[model samples]
Target: MFTLKIITANGNEVIHAAQDPIFHQASNTITFQGYDNLSNSVTLGEGLTSAGGDVAYLMGASGATLATWRYRQPVQCGSSLQPMDC
Candidate 1:
């Protein structure tokens, strides 16, 4: 497994697993979850997927970007949906 570090414009950092990090994706939105560096708890985050950009902004609870990460192609997993395969 790999880690995705999201760095915001204001310097806030959120870390997430690179695998299966994207919880939801739509025509214009991509929703995800990660751990806040300060709290170490899972925080809900979102990003835009409409512009076909390699980078996406991860939004915080206040609707501001807490961080950003480069988009990576996801690998297909087997029926077990194990992390080792995804």
Candidate 2:
């Protein structure tokens, strides 16, 4: 099962659009980090903004942290997905 969860810093949750291709990629990459980020920033920029101060992660079925989800990148692309609109 692919799991991507985003919980806000204020104790709220950010629900992902499951069918969104952006999320599909985020949920798939297990070794994502740094410049190789599995970014959700594009989604966040579009309208997925409840995740601003989020505690987000991509998890494996065994409950390990595969990757951490990033919410936004002001003037750049945070991942291999769509580039952030500048």
Candidate 3:
């Protein structure tokens, strides 16, 4: 099972969860850390995002899938609240 936990800065447990992957690819590697350089600044589980990669030994993917759901990058809003459009 997949597990997620949110901890307080002082080392307290704020939240936790268990989940399962919709898909898995064995013998696959994640070559890229994110969609693009802009992805570097974006945090996981925040805002619109894209992720996939093929590397040496590690292969992992998160977020919704086409079979279960669909997603689109939002338009740029040019505001501090959201740094990028999507």
Candidate 4:
């Protein structure tokens, strides 16, 4: 499973997926359930992707940047379930 961690000024949030999270490449929008420190669920308002699609700007209902999600490259270790040249 792949986990996305978003760092924010308030604290940190996370999203889990069986694969890499999906987002609109053209619109650069993303929708996901974000967990708070208390493990409470909240809907991510709207988000924007970076030009390189390497970063995501998570916004709040008020259109403020709540957190930032950075894309992490999958590990290429031989033992990993996903195949890759190592």
Model 4 misplaced stretches (Cα beyond 4 Å): 1-53, 81-86
What is the lDDT, from 0 to 100, of the residue 68 in candidate 1?
A: 55
After superposition, the stretches of candidate 3 with alpha carbons farther than 4 Å from their true spots are 20-80, 83-86
Score every model by TM-score. Answer: 0.27, 0.41, 0.23, 0.28
Task: Put down candidate 3 lDDT per residue, 1-86, tens digits, no spaces.
Answer: 22223222233332212233222222111112233222111112222223321111112235322121112223445442332333
Candidate numbers, best lDDT first, in rank order: 2, 1, 4, 3
Give the Cα RMSD of candidate 4.
12.4
In model 2, the clashing pairs are none
Better of 1 and 2 by lDDT: 2
Positional deviation of residue 33's Cα in model 4 after best superposition, in angstroms: 11
Once model 2 is optimally superposed onto the true structure by TM-score, how far is the C-alpha of residue 13 displaced, in angstroms?
3.4
Q: List model 2 lDDT by residue over 20-57, tens digit each.
A: 22332332222322233343342322234454544556
> Per-residue lDDT of 1-86 in model 4, one digit per residue for the tens?
23444443333454333132355332333444334322222233233433222454545445565556443434457666332335
Question: Who is ahead in TM-score, 2 or 4?
Answer: 2
Model 2 alpha-carbon drift over 4 Å, by segment: 14-42, 45-52, 76-86
Q: Please report the candidate that would top TM-score against the real structure.
A: 2
Clash pairs (backbone) in predicted model 3:
29-54, 29-55, 30-53, 30-54, 30-55, 31-53, 31-54, 31-55, 76-85
After aligning candidate 4 to the native by TM-score, how far in Å is the CA of 55 from where it should be?
A: 1.1
Clashing pairs for predicted structure model 1, backbone only: none
RMSD to native for every prediction?
A: 11.5, 10.2, 15.9, 12.4
